[model samples]
Target: MPDITHEEWLRRAESWKVSGAHHIDGADEPGGGATFTVVSPRDGRVLAEVADGGTAEVDAAVAAARRAFDTGPWPRLAPAERGRVLLRIADLLEERREELALTVSLEMGKPVTEAYAIELRAVIGTFRWYGHLADKLTDESPHTPQDALALVTREATGVVGAVVPWNFPLTLAGWKVAPALAAGCTVVLKPSENSPLSALLLGRIATEAGLPPGALNVVAGNGPVAGRALGLHPDVDVLAFTGSTAVGRHFLHYAADSNLKRVWLELGGKSPNIILPDAPDLAKAAATAAWGIFFNQGEMCTAPSRLLVHSSVAEQVTDAIVARADALRVGDPLDPATEMGALVSAGHLGRVLDHVGTGLDEGARLRAGGERTLTGTGGSYLRPTVFDRVAPGMRLSREEIFGPVLSVLTFDDLDEAVALANATEYGLAAGLWTSDLSTAHRVSRALKAGTVWVNCYEEGDLSVPFGGMKQSGNGRDKSVHALEKYTELKTTWIQL
Candidate 1:
């Protein structure tokens, strides 16, 4: 209908203020309830006021979800019926794609183009993927002697509390919520305060799509307030969260202190993007590596913040990467042509710059951009930054700098490359670019991350499992593996 622009986005943002009551038991849409102001990272402007809650709303949401799982018709429905409802939700998401994308852009400060082309598409695809998958789940039967029968059944783990981060809000939330809903588990979703509008809107769209009351809940607030309550609530059977490793650990204690509920965490990463001397195309590898770290302002958990290269080609790759970094367009997020946008908030911008300063002091040479670009619109804009000659022991290479900063490291051999890639405690994802099939196979297996890309970066499919290893956290997010997180297995034996 209308070309994407800041004016049109702001017009809508001003009107969508007052994020309302928690969507518990499927109350008719939302009302005036958002307890906090949602500021647009594009400018220091109040985009909206979203609903906020503490232990009270968390308790109510858990109660509603518990009732839904224990006695509601949702859990009793045929798998096909559940699939149909999820499909309807996917349809509605596409119908409202533009508005949803704009809402995400206004709140999360991602480029509108990426918001529409990448994120919105992925959000819709996830629902449809899980929708179709709903009916595919079946129980297992064990072979037994003639006198007895044994059955292994996977049942809903009951109420789920999902806490999502600001970056990739809806897509990440979908990773947690979709499979859980498909498996018949009710959910209380706590979206990041920095970007709650899309999830809040989803609460309304879901009800319009025929989801039963209490089946899905969206609580908008900070992790300490609403999230702690969700974690500590005895009725919440599972806590599925995607955020920092620090916060993920906090939820563990909440679970231990409460009901010992199951916890599935998709936490932090400093994923490595390695390029061997045999890379088929150094240009392509360099371009892709730059995009991997700078896309979404380098806010991705799997952003490939570290780049390990064979010493033979290290200088060439670094030069190409710096060129790509310097060429990125950084400014207003609402403009469709913008390649990168602001960090999520002013505070986040400070953190990013702080990391850059620390990197400079740690002796990493600044090869490209290393300063914040004031947008003149109060947006938290940062130039795509690159650091060369980064040592493995330096914090610049070790810490997860969740900004548009890339650290270049050199390796003399494949063994050293693999060791450098796996040295980080966080191992959510890794990538390698090479023409050698044997090296690809060998290095892919040696990397201890959950997902490894042989010749690409950040390419994904809903059918694959997404998660981490070691301190990056446990369990998976996408595919059938994710559904397992929301279910409990029970073995039934009967004597005939």
Candidate 2:
């Protein structure tokens, strides 16, 4: 499909409707409980009244997933057959590409263009990649005595409880759900209360693509209710979560307090992007620094919120970034020309603004774009903000702001640069822009983040594993390695 005009996108948004009930047993369930109003940050309008799933709803969903895993055909099917089903699901998602994109953009305040290109692309690619990889996996057999045979194989770990955040709802859910389903495990997905529409849509697509009843379920509610129940459920063999570091810790505690199920976390980050004086393209590095923090309104876990620049070129790089930030168009998300959209919600915007205030009070120089904007529309909009001459010890430099807020810190040498970059509690991702191969290799190795980009920020492929170290949480997402999280190894010995 071609790119539509902004007016066309607005027309589609007016006509769009969302699914608001919990999906269980291949159908939508009203849950017979109270509902919560979901407000769009794009225009501060009430989108829908989503079912507020609680422990009872969690129980039903988990029970459905448990039945599917224990006695259903989903787990008993051949790997190749299951692979075909996943491929069909991918095709179905592609078929509803426009609809799904609209749902995501309306629910989460992402640009319609980006929701179509980046978000849907990732979701579709994840399922398609895992589908192709499902049957190609192999088991292992070890050498043994002449009269004996030994075989080691992978088995599905049973029901998976996936709790994903709202920033990139469909993409993050797809990262967990596609791999778990590909590994022959049933799933009970609990999306964030702020953005559950797209996830409910995903559940319907899965059932329509020939998945058996009870194989995949979606429950939408607040974190303390449905998410807590899923984390503490004894029947779920594994729980995969992507959210804040504090929430990630709660899942670990829930695992220990309940069934000791395997818990995999992909948590928060305050990643650093370093620019050396010898960068191959200083202008490009500065532009990317602006894009890195401003993209998705900086609600990304791996957003380069901190920019560490060499002292000699700090002024030049900082000025370039400020210019780019000033040039960014902050407006309606449906407009294809708008580079930055609204924050996810009013509460989230308040939190981010508080952090901005703290930064100013802590003595960081506000370079450009530090206040709220577009108030006439009643949308949760903020300017692309940048703070220069940030000290290493400041709160803005250490905490994961998780917004379109950038902190610029200067370093005199390579040692100080690396030390400053590694100072934060997060180590999810980092970026470096340099021309020298030796410096690139040295800095990339020394950076403590899980993924380090030499000249790019947030560029990734399904072939590489993505996760974090330290307080950023644990385990891997994407690639074949992700399947390991949903499967267990079993060894069988035969004697002749």
Candidate 3:
């Protein structure tokens, strides 16, 4: 496909206007609360006026989900029948690919081309993969010495509350909703207030795909109000959330206080990307490191923000990465040619800037692109930032700065590199760049992260599990492990 110009991208975004306040019980209506503007991060243009839902609305949504799961046909439907509905939703997403991508780009400020190619496509693929796997989930039979019959069954965990971040709204929503629905559970989703349009649109698609009323509901609201209510609701059986580590801890506390509902959180990260001197193709390693940190404006939880370079080629790798970061295009997200887009909102941009200031105060050298704003851009734009000579103890190296900032740290040997990488409290994800078979195997085993990519960065597939360890939060989001989170296994024995 040819690259889309900025003007064309804007036009495409303007053309996608499926408006409503909320989608509850398989229908759309203006929410009870006042309307809020969903602005374009490219130019601060008013993309749409979305309904800002609150506690009452959340209660109603949860009630609807509970009613659907209790008395509706969704949970009673055969696994194959439920799979058909999910497959239909995936097909509908593909049919409206352009609109979905445009809405995502406008809401979250990701490059339009990348949003279409990566985010939307991945969402569709996730639905299809889980849909096919639904039928394969079955109960087990056991043999015993006694004259008795035994069976182990997997049952849906009833109502689920899914709260997704603005970084990858649709894709993350799919991560939570697809498996829940496939496992015969009903879901009420709360999208981030900064970017709720795409998820609302997805709710409409779910209805069109013939999902039962209240099986999938979209409630758009802030974290303090709607998100807190979802986590604390007694009726919600499971809470699946993806956001900052601070908020994840709060959700865990809320779950503990409110009915002890199962909470699955995929939270923050300062993931490390280690590059040993023996790695073949230094240029490729440097480019991958740059993309790993700068992709999606570094808003991803799995983004490799820490670069650990061997002392022998630390200077060489840092120089190459700096050059690549400098070359990244930071402009209107609607422009297909653009590589980086604005942060999700003005407040987030300010927080990212504050982290840059903290880095400078910690005495780290700002090697390139620090505290620079895009000229003539109306949105919350920040230039790609790189810090060199950063020690592991520095705030910038330890904290999860969810922006386009890369911190380069040098290590004298492989053992030190592994120690520095695992020093942080977080263990979401990490990367290694090397060609030596023994070194790669040794380092991959030593890393404390949940997912380790050797010679690659941020590469994910639907078949593999995705989640975090330590302070990054628990419970897998993708793969068959996700199904386990959404289900409960029961064992029964009977005398023959």
TM for every model, in the order presented, reads 0.97, 0.99, 0.98
Q: List CA RMSD, all candidates.
A: 1.8, 0.9, 1.3
lDDT of 1: 0.88
- Evaluated at residue 327, the lDDT of candidate 1 is 85
Predicted model with the maximum lDDT: 2
User: For all candidates, what are the clash counts?
Assistant: 7, 0, 0
| Ranked by lDDT, top first | 2, 3, 1
lDDT of 1 by residue, 39-60 (tens): 9898889876566777777777
- Tell me the RMSD of model 2 versus the true structure: 0.9
Distance (Å) between predicted and true CA of 36, model 3? 2.6
Question: Which runs of model 2 end up more than 4 angstroms from their true locations?
Answer: none
Candidate 2 local lDDT, 1-496, one digit each (tens): 4479999989998888987999998999999678999999999999999999999999999999999999999999988988899899999999999888888888889898899899999999999999999899999999999999999999999999999999999999999999999999999999999999999999999999999988899999999889999999999999999999999999999999999999999999999999999999999999999999999999999999999999999999999999999999999999989889999999999999999999999999999988999999888999999999799889999888889999999999999999999998999999999999999999999999999999888897999999999999888999999999999999999997
lDDT of each: 0.88, 0.93, 0.89
Candidate 1 stretches greater than 4 Å from native = 1-18, 28-34
TM-score (C-alpha) between model 1 and the true structure: 0.97
Comparing 1 with 3 on lDDT, the higher-scoring candidate is: 3
Roughly what TM-score does model 3 have, to 2 decimal places?
Answer: 0.98
lDDT of 3 by residue, 294-326 (tens): 899989888889999998998898898889877
